[model samples]
Target: MDETENGNLSSDYIAWTIVANVLAKQMNMAGPSAAYNGQAPLSEAQMKRIHDYFFGRLHGGFQIAELAATLGMSRTSFFKRFGRTARVTPNQYLQILRVEKAKILLRNENLTLIEIAFACGYADQSHLARFFKRYVRMSPGRYRSKMREEDVA
Candidate 1:
């Protein structure tokens, strides 16, 4: 590895060690979840507006420009603020939300995989299956079968 990578590895190890020692001593000084320093994250109002817009138009194509417009923010500003607030890029958050909705619909047993895919905002069944496997560690079809088995038992 390069010098920078080695330095980062050591820094990460030191940080984790400090956290581990603190946890062992039952010190709750910083807690596990700490807010980052520097640029402000999105406010609650901004987050709520984003959530409302995203869910309301869940099955359609999204544009960062469109979202930025709704919040009166420039695209660059919106991207940075959203990353800070959500801990993921906007598109990543959208995919996760889509997969979650698909999971819920899968339990119904009435919706076919294609229906679930489109309903959850994926382009098609294969698209849903790809991300579903990535996030849930199984294909949607397999996940549905597992859910059905659990329902019976």
Candidate 2:
């Protein structure tokens, strides 16, 4: 709740914000009808193209600026559009993608952590470890050991 400095309740700001966001989402789902009333949202095909372009180059150190250029949008615009369509920003999507790929690579004992890091588009083992801790809640070595245990079972 939002209120004056004196502390009496003035507005349910959080509830209204949630309602506004939900209504905006519903309007976005309404598509062309909503577009005719306001600005046209990206079409399904446009969104697919964006996803395809991003995934196709995901392994080659793709940048938000590069993706924005491919979509003919500014960085902020592309970030908003991609977030609305994918429910995650480009960097989040890329990190998740890389982490998923790293999981698969982890099964290969022949690869070192540094090698896996490079393969997964991370700068180094430390970079991979940081994201693993953030996303997977464990270090890469721990994740690999857990996978190993699961496999043996």
Candidate 3:
């Protein structure tokens, strides 16, 4: 609910989508004939390529069509496959990546939230906070504080 209210899901999920599944495998659970495995969303190699590209361009936002072209996939194919594999839209995946990046960046006491936001490709600090809270369930500042406390402990 919060994700939809905030207009997004967490970026951490994106960082971990982490698979390729078997297509020909038979399911023996339902009398051995209920169904066969569905095709995997993308190959491990393809996911790695997408992750690399997204990481490389993290600081600069991108368009879905542009990303599709970069992957040599049609927009529809890319969207469908990514959605199937990651269980979230490409834009949502990007947001998860951004939030995860922000989490790491928050460890640095010197840089402000605004810097972290831009570093993670958000429009501003508030943008980072909104998504961060939605996905992480805490404000960035509080998260940073908690992390710092953990470090001290």
Candidate 1, clashing residue pairs? Answer: none
Model 2, range 23-88, lDDT digits (tens) per residue? 999978877663333234667987787767656765676777877787677777667666766777
Best by lDDT: 1
> What would you estimate as the lDDT of candidate 2?
0.78
TM-scores across all candidates?
Answer: 0.69, 0.62, 0.69
lDDT, model 2, position 144: 92
| Candidates arranged by TM-score, highest first | 3, 1, 2
Q: Ten consecutive residues with minimal summed lDDT in candidate 3?
A: 18-27
lDDT of 3 by residue, 7-123 (tens): 355544443342112222333333342111323477788789888878877777767888778777777778877888889887787788889999999999999999999899888
Give the whole-model CA lDDT for all candidates, comma-separated: 0.84, 0.78, 0.79
What is candidate 1's CA lDDT for residue 152? 90
Model 1 ranges with Cα > 4 A deviation: 1-38
